[model samples]
Target: MPTARIYQRPKNAMQSGKARTDRWQLEYEPAEPQRPDPLTGWAGSGDTRGQIRLGFPTMEAAVAYAEREGVAYTVVPAPTKTLKLQSYADNFK
Candidate 1:
Protein backbone atom coordinates (compact mmCIF):
# COMPACT_ATOMS: atom_id res chain seq x y z
CA MET A 1 0.00 0.00 0.00
CA PRO A 2 1.15 3.50 -0.80
CA THR A 3 0.86 6.42 1.60
CA ALA A 4 -0.55 9.74 0.45
CA ARG A 5 -1.01 13.28 1.70
CA ILE A 6 -4.13 15.45 1.37
CA TYR A 7 -3.92 19.22 1.62
CA GLN A 8 -5.19 22.45 0.16
CA ARG A 9 -3.12 24.21 -2.43
CA PRO A 10 -1.30 27.26 -1.24
CA LYS A 11 -1.09 30.60 -3.01
CA ASN A 12 1.78 30.91 -5.41
CA ALA A 13 4.53 33.18 -4.15
CA MET A 14 5.23 34.64 -7.59
CA GLN A 15 1.78 36.16 -8.01
CA SER A 16 -0.71 38.14 -5.91
CA GLY A 17 -3.68 36.23 -7.30
CA LYS A 18 -5.36 33.45 -5.32
CA ALA A 19 -6.49 31.37 -8.26
CA ARG A 20 -6.56 27.56 -7.84
CA THR A 21 -5.78 27.80 -4.14
CA ASP A 22 -9.25 26.59 -3.15
CA ARG A 23 -8.70 23.09 -4.49
CA TRP A 24 -7.35 20.21 -2.43
CA GLN A 25 -4.58 17.98 -3.70
CA LEU A 26 -3.56 14.42 -3.07
CA GLU A 27 0.09 13.41 -3.52
CA TYR A 28 1.74 10.10 -2.92
CA GLU A 29 4.74 9.85 -0.70
CA PRO A 30 8.00 9.03 -2.46
CA ALA A 31 8.44 5.29 -2.68
CA GLU A 32 12.11 5.64 -3.47
CA PRO A 33 14.77 8.26 -3.15
CA GLN A 34 15.81 10.24 -6.24
CA ARG A 35 19.24 9.68 -7.62
CA PRO A 36 21.33 11.60 -10.11
CA ASP A 37 21.22 10.10 -13.58
CA PRO A 38 24.48 8.69 -14.77
CA LEU A 39 24.31 10.40 -18.15
CA THR A 40 22.61 13.78 -17.69
CA GLY A 41 23.33 14.20 -13.95
CA TRP A 42 19.71 15.20 -13.46
CA ALA A 43 17.79 13.82 -10.52
CA GLY A 44 15.49 10.95 -11.43
CA SER A 45 13.29 8.43 -9.74
CA GLY A 46 11.86 5.05 -10.75
CA ASP A 47 8.67 5.63 -8.77
CA THR A 48 6.12 6.93 -11.25
CA ARG A 49 3.59 7.48 -8.48
CA GLY A 50 5.68 10.38 -7.27
CA GLN A 51 4.73 12.29 -10.40
CA ILE A 52 0.99 11.87 -9.93
CA ARG A 53 -1.10 14.65 -8.41
CA LEU A 54 -4.87 14.52 -8.00
CA GLY A 55 -7.01 17.55 -7.38
CA PHE A 56 -10.44 17.65 -5.75
CA PRO A 57 -12.85 20.49 -5.17
CA THR A 58 -13.02 19.70 -1.48
CA MET A 59 -10.97 17.95 1.19
CA GLU A 60 -13.69 15.36 1.84
CA ALA A 61 -13.67 14.32 -1.79
CA ALA A 62 -9.94 13.80 -1.69
CA VAL A 63 -10.13 11.72 1.45
CA ALA A 64 -12.96 9.60 0.04
CA TYR A 65 -10.97 8.75 -3.04
CA ALA A 66 -7.98 7.72 -0.99
CA GLU A 67 -10.16 5.56 1.20
CA ARG A 68 -11.81 3.89 -1.79
CA GLU A 69 -8.42 3.10 -3.24
CA GLY A 70 -7.22 1.60 0.02
CA VAL A 71 -4.37 4.05 0.09
CA ALA A 72 -3.02 5.06 3.47
CA TYR A 73 -3.27 8.78 3.74
CA THR A 74 -2.63 11.64 6.10
CA VAL A 75 -4.44 14.94 5.95
CA VAL A 76 -2.21 17.96 6.38
CA PRO A 77 -4.06 20.96 7.74
CA ALA A 78 -3.76 24.07 5.65
CA PRO A 79 -1.70 26.88 7.06
CA THR A 80 -3.56 29.93 8.29
CA LYS A 81 -3.16 33.21 6.44
CA THR A 82 -2.87 36.44 8.36
CA LEU A 83 -3.49 39.73 6.61
CA LYS A 84 -1.99 43.01 7.69
CA LEU A 85 -4.30 45.83 6.65
CA GLN A 86 -2.45 48.90 5.53
CA SER A 87 -3.06 51.74 3.12
CA TYR A 88 -0.79 52.75 0.25
CA ALA A 89 0.05 55.91 2.20
CA ASP A 90 1.78 53.77 4.84
CA ASN A 91 4.50 53.00 2.34
CA PHE A 92 5.52 56.64 2.39
CA LYS A 93 6.15 56.56 6.13
Candidate 2:
Protein backbone atom coordinates (compact mmCIF):
# COMPACT_ATOMS: atom_id res chain seq x y z
CA MET A 1 0.00 0.00 0.00
CA PRO A 2 1.20 3.50 -0.76
CA THR A 3 1.88 5.44 2.44
CA ALA A 4 1.08 9.03 3.17
CA ARG A 5 1.52 11.60 5.93
CA ILE A 6 -0.79 14.12 7.60
CA TYR A 7 0.83 16.83 9.64
CA GLN A 8 0.41 20.36 10.87
CA ARG A 9 2.59 22.92 9.17
CA PRO A 10 5.07 24.42 11.56
CA LYS A 11 5.51 28.16 11.63
CA ASN A 12 8.41 29.32 9.54
CA ALA A 13 11.41 30.39 11.61
CA MET A 14 11.38 33.88 10.12
CA GLN A 15 7.63 34.21 10.51
CA SER A 16 6.52 36.41 13.33
CA GLY A 17 2.78 36.12 12.79
CA LYS A 18 0.64 32.95 12.99
CA ALA A 19 -0.57 33.17 9.41
CA ARG A 20 0.44 29.69 8.20
CA THR A 21 0.57 27.73 11.43
CA ASP A 22 -3.15 27.02 11.29
CA ARG A 23 -2.87 25.05 8.10
CA TRP A 24 -2.20 21.33 7.89
CA GLN A 25 -0.60 19.46 5.03
CA LEU A 26 -0.92 16.05 3.40
CA GLU A 27 1.98 14.59 1.44
CA TYR A 28 2.99 11.24 0.07
CA GLU A 29 6.28 9.56 0.89
CA PRO A 30 8.58 9.13 -2.08
CA ALA A 31 8.65 5.55 -3.33
CA GLU A 32 11.51 6.07 -5.76
CA PRO A 33 15.22 6.53 -5.30
CA GLN A 34 17.43 9.27 -6.67
CA ARG A 35 19.47 8.03 -9.61
CA PRO A 36 22.20 9.73 -11.62
CA ASP A 37 21.33 10.62 -15.21
CA PRO A 38 23.74 9.09 -17.69
CA LEU A 39 23.34 11.87 -20.20
CA THR A 40 23.74 14.81 -17.87
CA GLY A 41 25.87 13.15 -15.18
CA TRP A 42 23.69 14.88 -12.58
CA ALA A 43 21.40 13.40 -9.96
CA GLY A 44 17.92 13.33 -11.44
CA SER A 45 15.21 15.17 -9.55
CA GLY A 46 13.33 12.29 -8.01
CA ASP A 47 11.72 13.98 -5.05
CA THR A 48 8.34 14.12 -6.70
CA ARG A 49 6.40 13.49 -3.52
CA GLY A 50 7.02 16.99 -2.28
CA GLN A 51 5.82 18.40 -5.55
CA ILE A 52 2.26 18.18 -4.32
CA ARG A 53 1.41 19.59 -0.92
CA LEU A 54 -2.28 19.54 -0.05
CA GLY A 55 -3.14 22.13 2.51
CA PHE A 56 -6.20 22.16 4.75
CA PRO A 57 -7.49 24.76 7.12
CA THR A 58 -7.63 22.30 9.98
CA MET A 59 -5.90 19.12 11.01
CA GLU A 60 -9.15 17.19 11.25
CA ALA A 61 -10.06 18.17 7.72
CA ALA A 62 -6.70 16.99 6.46
CA VAL A 63 -7.12 13.67 8.24
CA ALA A 64 -10.63 13.25 6.94
CA TYR A 65 -9.54 13.77 3.36
CA ALA A 66 -6.80 11.19 3.71
CA GLU A 67 -9.28 8.69 5.13
CA ARG A 68 -11.85 9.38 2.44
CA GLU A 69 -9.20 8.80 -0.20
CA GLY A 70 -8.18 5.50 1.46
CA VAL A 71 -4.68 6.72 1.98
CA ALA A 72 -2.63 5.12 4.74
CA TYR A 73 -1.26 8.01 6.65
CA THR A 74 0.63 8.86 9.82
CA VAL A 75 0.16 12.12 11.63
CA VAL A 76 3.23 14.07 12.60
CA PRO A 77 2.58 16.65 15.28
CA ALA A 78 4.14 20.06 15.03
CA PRO A 79 6.98 20.85 17.38
CA THR A 80 6.01 22.84 20.44
CA LYS A 81 7.78 26.05 21.30
CA THR A 82 8.04 26.83 25.00
CA LEU A 83 10.04 29.99 24.96
CA LYS A 84 8.73 32.66 27.28
CA LEU A 85 8.34 36.14 25.89
CA GLN A 86 11.18 38.42 26.89
CA SER A 87 11.62 42.13 26.57
CA TYR A 88 14.61 43.91 25.15
CA ALA A 89 15.26 45.45 28.58
CA ASP A 90 15.40 41.97 30.06
CA ASN A 91 18.69 41.48 28.28
CA PHE A 92 20.23 43.97 30.68
CA LYS A 93 19.25 41.90 33.69
Instruction: List the RMSD of every prediction in angstroms.
Output: 1.0, 2.2
Instruction: Give the TM-score (vs. native) of candidate 1.
Output: 0.93
- How high is the lDDT of residue 13 in model 2? 77
Candidate 1: clashing pairs of residues: none
Model 1 spans with C-alpha error above 4 angstroms: none
* Cα lDDT of model 2 by residue, 1-93, tens digit: 667898887777786877878788999887787688999988756667657889999889988988898888999988887889999999999
Q: Ten residues in a row with the worst lDDT in model 2?
A: 43-52
TM-score per candidate: 0.93, 0.79
Q: Identify the leading candidate in terms of TM-score.
A: 1
lDDT of 2 at 62: 87
Give Cα-based local distance difference scores for all models: 0.98, 0.84
